[model samples]
Target: MNNPIVLNAFRFVLLLLAQVLIFNGLNFMGTINPMVYVIFLYWYPIKENRAVFLLVAFLLGLLIDIFSDSLALHTLAILTAAFARPFIMRFCFGVNYEFQNFTFKNTTKIQRITYLALLIVLHHTIFFCFEILSFSHILLILKKILSTSLLTIFLCTLFSSLFSPKSE
Candidate 1:
């Protein structure tokens, strides 16, 4: 699993299954769903070509859209977040991002959390925004985005801490 390629491939499958089979059903208060699949994009090797990375991000979201029947909502949100990922990485990790993959071993805990939190918020914000195309439900959409982002961010941060290796 240390092999980055093999690891990310497994993540794709694992996260897709988890998203569709598990988290998809765990909607809280009928409005919040934890998006664990975005973790794949978060942890992909930084050295890979940027174009390919964006393609993978779009395809990953498209896969979820297919299963969840959310049309292009997932694809749009995930792609946006994926496109913004490099910028966010630079913001969070700065020069160290050029030298290594995004991982817990090299990055500080707060930085890792901030990185994931920002992406989650972006993803959820876009997701809820598209979901409510009309201003009629502005309040509801805002509420969903806020609550869902918070829950998803917390879970993502916890997952990062639990699964990512600590620095030696």
Candidate 2:
């Protein structure tokens, strides 16, 4: 049961369903949409295998795009986030980051919060950028990105805190 394939497959299905069913319908004021599905990518193991991880992230986003009829916006955003995650993790965890099993307790809450905030912001920025696809509505797109990124970060962090393992 040490294989990450089966574990990640299960996580992918669960997070996808959650995103499409629960999160998709939860836009506060029609402006705040949380992309909780990216949590799966955020928590994925093995920071060393960048190529495989990006492929998985792309596939996950493609699946969401297929379901949501949003074209490749999700795919692009997710791939970007996956590609940027290792650097974010390294910055957040410093020299202690483990490629095999990274735990939240290894870093301070401030660091974890910073990591989550940056990743969600990056993901939402890319998503909203392509979603708007127009410089004419730059202000509107920026609003959407800011609002949605905050909501996503808030919700994701709250949920993560609930299940976070206490340090021994």
Candidate 3:
């Protein structure tokens, strides 16, 4: 039960199903859809193989894209987030990120929040930019990104707090 691989696989399936079945149909103010699946990227092991992480990220986004019929938007956004995760972590966690044994559980709350916010904002920005694909609707893109990112951050924080393993 404590195996990281099994836990990750379970998280992947659970988050994927939640996004496709629940979040996909949900709309607030007609456009804000909370993308809670992004949490999987945050929760993935830091020491895991980078290739496998990117592959899983692509597959996750591909699955969401298929369900939402959003072409490749989710795929691109998620892959970008996954690719940029190390840099984000380094920025948030400072020198501690260089250690192979580093984990989010050991980080400060502010660092975790900042890391989550950056990733969510980045993912939403890319997603909305390509989704709208129009300079005329830049306001609309920003609106969607802000609203959706807030909702996602809240939900992700709530979910992570609820499910996160307690420090012994």
Candidate 2, run of 10 with poorest lDDT = 159-168
Candidate closest to the true structure, highest lDDT: 3
- The lDDT values for all models are 0.84, 0.83, 0.91
When 1 and 3 are scored with lDDT, the better candidate is: 3
Better model by TM-score: candidate 1 vs candidate 2: 1
Candidate 3: pairs in clash: none
Residue 144 local lDDT, model 1:
87
Residues 5-101, candidate 2: write the lDDT tens digits. 7867888998899998888888788647689887776667744478888999999999999989999999999999999897887888886775445
Question: Tens digits of per-residue lDDT for model 3 on 34-62?
Answer: 99999998889888899999999999999
Residue lDDT tens for model 1, 6-119: 877888888899899999999788857888887777777778899988898988999999999999999999999999998998999887777645455766778878888889
Name the top TM-score candidate: 3
Collision count for each candidate, in order: 0, 0, 0
Q: Model 2 reaches what TM-score against the true structure? A: 0.88
Which ranking of candidates, highest lDDT first?
3, 1, 2
Count of backbone collisions within predicted model 3: 0
Candidate 1 at residue 50, lDDT?
A: 90
